[model samples]
Target: MGTGNNRTITKTRRKIRDVDQIKADLLCARHLEQFKDSKRPEDLPGLGQNYCIECAKWFDTETTLKAHKRGKPHKRRVKQLREEPEPDPRRIPGAQTTSQSIGQCYDTQSAHVAHMEVDT
Candidate 1:
């Protein structure tokens, strides 16, 4: 019913990646590596069980730890930890609060789940 010239002009939008976002992602990855290394023990514990300080999770055995390493929740946590800034020790309330544990930052549901797991 209308002339061709009357049709609305639709512009094709260009997909542009944000440089800041890229930089932030790189920074997050670096921070995550640092955080992970900060808690890693030079020698494996005598106990068979292995602990993940970042997620406040304990693997009762090496097999369990291997499985946990490949799990989605653990992967998600690694990404989340990468993005989060380190907590300030001064903000923590304790006589000798040199560092804040990741357990203290976990959600109630996560805490409950961690607690529900029986150490075998």
Candidate 2:
């Protein structure tokens, strides 16, 4: 059998945070690899620059978007998103209207689930 010291010295080791680094590297790599692969520059919509990570959409000015992306609140929100999953869709449907469903208890008055009225 091989000696313990020699075996330990010969063993291969990998970086503890290598996976995270690899993912980040891959994300960064995409911009270079994908950009070159697609030669048609004009085909890209809003091709001049990038959008802010915070805004997740286009920005009129690159400098303005960069400033917003660097803000503390934006970073904090990004961190929060990484930690928590998105909320359930059923929890919030959409704009709520005044309506009463069956089995719902009413204390003062009863009204429909939604009501649209125009002012006179």
The lDDT per prediction is 0.49, 0.46
Summarize candidate 2's per-residue lDDT along 4-106 as a digit string, tens digits: 6755555543212233332333345553344335445454335635544323334456776778788886687567545534555765555454433333333
TM-score computed on alpha carbons, candidate 1: 0.31
TM-score of 2: 0.29
Q: What is the lDDT of residue 5 in candidate 1?
A: 54
Q: Count the backbone clashes (under 3 Å) in each candidate.
A: 0, 4
Clashing pairs in 1: none
RMSD for each model, in Å, please? 19.1, 21.5
